[model samples]
Target: MTIKLNLIAAACENMGIGKNNNLPWKLKSEMDYFSRMTSKTIDPTKKNVVIMGRKTWDSIPTKYKPLQNRINFVLSRSNLDLKNCKDVYASNSLESCIEKLEDNAFKSVYETVWVIGGRHIYEAALKSDSFHRLYLTKILKTFDCDTFFPPLPTNLKKVSDPDVPEELQTENGIDYTYNVYENTQFGK
Candidate 1:
C-alpha cells in the first residue's frame, strides 16, 4: 500500500523558518491555517500523522505537546523521552517512520502523514520520492532568522491557487498566501 506523504511549512521572503528554534514571526492567521490543515481529516475518528524532527517537537510549547487530535511522531537518533505526553511516538529516522506507516495495522488507520519539520527534516523529505505535495506558505516579508527552509526541487511544480480560500492573504503588513506544489515526476 502507498501512503501519500506531505510536507507543510511557512517561510519568510528569505526562506527563513525559525530563529533560536522558535518561530521568528507571530502571525496568528498563519498559525491558525497551520492548525486547521494539520488537524483536518476526512474521518474524524482517524487522526493524521505528523512526522517532525526532534527539535521541532521540542520547539512546540508544553501545552501543545501532542498537537491535539493528531498522532505525533518525532524523529530522533537519541533516546527519546516524551515525558508522559499522550499520542506521541518516536522514530529514529524518516525512513523508519514511513516504514511504520506502511504497516498493515496503521496504513488504514491514518489519514495523511505530514512532515512538520525543522529545516533538516524538510530537506530530507524534499530529497525523498515518497513525499508527494508541499503545502507551503509564502511569507512576503523578511525576518531575522537562524534557520531556513530548504530550496525547492526543480522537479516539483507549484499548482495554481485559484481555489484556495485565502489565495492571497495580507495581515500585519505582510503579504502571504498558501501554495501547493506537486511532484511532476511522481508516478513515473
Candidate 2:
C-alpha cells in the first residue's frame, strides 16, 4: 500500500532547524500550529501519527508528551525502552514503523501520518516514496544552528492550504510565513 506522509517543521532562512538538540527559537503560535496540524483528524474515532527520530522525541518536554491526542512513533537504531511510555511506539527504522502502521490493527486507527523531525529523519522522509506534502514555517530571520533541514527537492511546488494563514506572522520580534509544498511528481 502507498502511504502518503507529510513532513512538518520550522526553519530559519539558512534552513536551520535546531540548536543544542532543541528548537532554536520558540513561537507559541508556531507550536500551536504544529499541535493543531498533527492532532487534527476528520474522523473522530481515528488519531494521526507523528513520526520522529529518537532525538526529537527526547527533545520534547516531559510534560507535553507523548503529545496528547496523537500516536507517537520514535525511530531509533538502538533498543530504546519504551514499554512504559504510553501512546508511544519504538521502532528501529522508519520503514519498520511504517510497516506496523500498515498492519491490520493500525490501518483503521490512524487518519494521517506526519514526519516531525530531526535532520536525518527529515532527510530520509524526503526521499521516501511515501513523501507527500510539507508544511514548513519559514522564519524570516537566520539563527545559529548546529542542525539544519535538508534542501527541498526541485520537484516540490508551493501550494496553499486553508489551515495555513497566507499573511506574514510575527512573534517575539521575528517574522515568518507558513508554506505548504507538494511533490509535483506525486499528484496529490
Per-candidate TM vs. native? Answer: 0.94, 0.97
TM-score of 1: 0.94
Clash total of candidate 1: 0
Please provide, for model 2 over 84-151, each residue's C-alpha lDDT reduced to its tens digit, 9 standing for 90 to 100. Answer: 88889999988898789889878899999999999889999898878899999999999999999998
Candidate 1's residue-wise lDDT over 1-188, tens digit each? 38777899999999999999999888998899888888888897798999999889989998888899889999999989876878888989888888999999887778988898989899988877787888899999899999999988889887864434655898888889899998786656
Error of 2 at 82 (Å): 0.6
The collision pairs in model 1 are none
CA shift of 54, model 2, Å: 0.6
For model 2, what is the error of residue 161's alpha carbon versus the real structure, in angstroms, after optimal superposition? 1.5
Residue ranges of candidate 1 with Cα displaced over 4 Å: 160-163
Residue 5 miss distance in model 1 (angstroms): 1.4
